[model samples]
Target: MLLVPRQLLRAGMTGDVPYYGGRFSPAQAYAAAHPQPRPAPPPPAPTSRADQQLAALQNLFAAGVLTAEEYQQFAARVTP
Candidate 1:
């Protein structure tokens, strides 16, 4: 038959007393008991027809297909 001291068992269960020369701090014990929550993933990127139209207008202006006045009119129509 073998017997262990209640105090030693209590200390081990509660991680209050150091064992084998290594101690468990309150923070470490709490962390071991409760883990931190993971951060939420970032939101997806936005997509809009206005963005596509703006890109198209820029391309058209660069290609000399649309004049300044035409670009302005197209921008006004496409913008929210």
Candidate 2:
């Protein structure tokens, strides 16, 4: 007697399509037939007051001016 796994048996019986096996399934084929919409470009990074404060804190930490404890405290305060 030949035995197939339940998932394979179910897949075979049902009309549902497979994805990422080796070849594209019916859904994938259909999607490929129709062109997909492109995603919008990401917004520019913030240059506001909060961002400035964060940048200042980062610079201070990097410059070895701010101790670890002071950096942590400043980070906690500045982080919205």
Candidate 3:
């Protein structure tokens, strides 16, 4: 394994590494000045009133509060 001096490693980590002869690389300078833009995240899907009512009916059926027939009837009414 190649070994580097502790001071050199510290300077590199802290972004203060000295150029070979007081000169900055062109690519490094350009990259520091210009950064790419990130795209915005997509918006969340909106829930409809019918969807909320159906979900409530499903929860009731799952809890044994509503029979299959009643659940289906309520679901049908909740939707268009």
Candidate 4:
């Protein structure tokens, strides 16, 4: 069995006296003041005609529209 004083319980729930006796612990306050920078988005994909053709061939191969042999043959043409 456990018992909590009503006033203390109310204070804890209403943020009058948080678990840490403050709005946040030292570490949490520091994190709120200084957040890490987010990584930049990845570079845009290549848009050259050959690159586009190669990507299209890859999609077709993935969808089973082009056989492995056909994909390889078309890719060779696009790359060189």
Candidate 5:
């Protein structure tokens, strides 16, 4: 296990361990000014009102809330 300089650590048997997020990191992890940019994640696909209704109908059928005939009729209105 890495250890922080005794001067940096509080007066205790254990030393101060550096952390990055929730995990430990080394004190030398950053030495100088640096910049690294990450691309943003792609946006989610947009959904149409018909598509939303279709998904709702499918869920209802899966949950046994809509009969097969009712689901088929509703699905026809949403699908091309």
Candidate 6:
């Protein structure tokens, strides 16, 4: 949102990282001309029930969808 970037967008000079504001960056346009399919990642090793619960809570907290107090409350439920 800086002045430079804002001006670039205004001038239609989108940078790297796919299309934005209905305009594709130079790299994105090139990529579109040549398509490639990436291999999917290997499945993760199975996790314990406790580990799964902890991960879920961590994701929610990291996304700021849960306050610290709410996080602690949910974490207690997962741990015990």
State each model's C-alpha RMSD to the native. Answer: 8.1, 15.0, 11.2, 11.2, 13.3, 22.1
Regions of candidate 6 where Cα sits further than 4 Å from its true position: 1-47
How do the residues 1-80 of candidate 5 rate in per-residue lDDT, one tens digit apiece? 55786665553544444336764344334433344577899998776887889989989999999999999998998887
Give the per-residue lDDT of model 4 (tens digit) for 1-80: 44988897788788894467546898899999999999999999775989888889999999999999999898988886
Model 6 over residues 1-80: C-alpha lDDT tens digits? 37665656755654433446778878889999999988999999765898988898999999999999999998898786
* Full-model lDDT, candidate 6: 0.82
Question: How many clashes show up per model?
Answer: 0, 0, 0, 0, 0, 0
Each prediction's TM-score against the native? 0.42, 0.39, 0.41, 0.41, 0.38, 0.40
> Residue 50 in model 4: shift from native, Å?
0.5
Please report, as a residue range, the 10-residue window in candidate 4 with the lowest summed lDDT.
15-24
Q: Please report, in order, the local distance difference test score of every candidate based on alpha carbons.
A: 0.87, 0.85, 0.85, 0.87, 0.75, 0.82
- Candidate 3, residue 45: the lDDT equals 71
Instruction: Kindly report which residue stretches of model 3 are placed more than 4 angstroms away from their true locations once superposed.
Output: 1-47
Candidate 2 positional error at 49, Å = 0.9
Evaluated against the true structure, the overall lDDT of model 2 is 0.85
Candidate 5 clashes between residue pairs 3 or more apart in a chain or in different chains: none
> At residue 59, what lDDT does model 2 achieve?
96
Better of 1 and 5 by TM-score: 1
Best candidate (score: TM-score): 1
| Clashing residue pairs, backbone N/CA/C < 3 A, model 1 | none
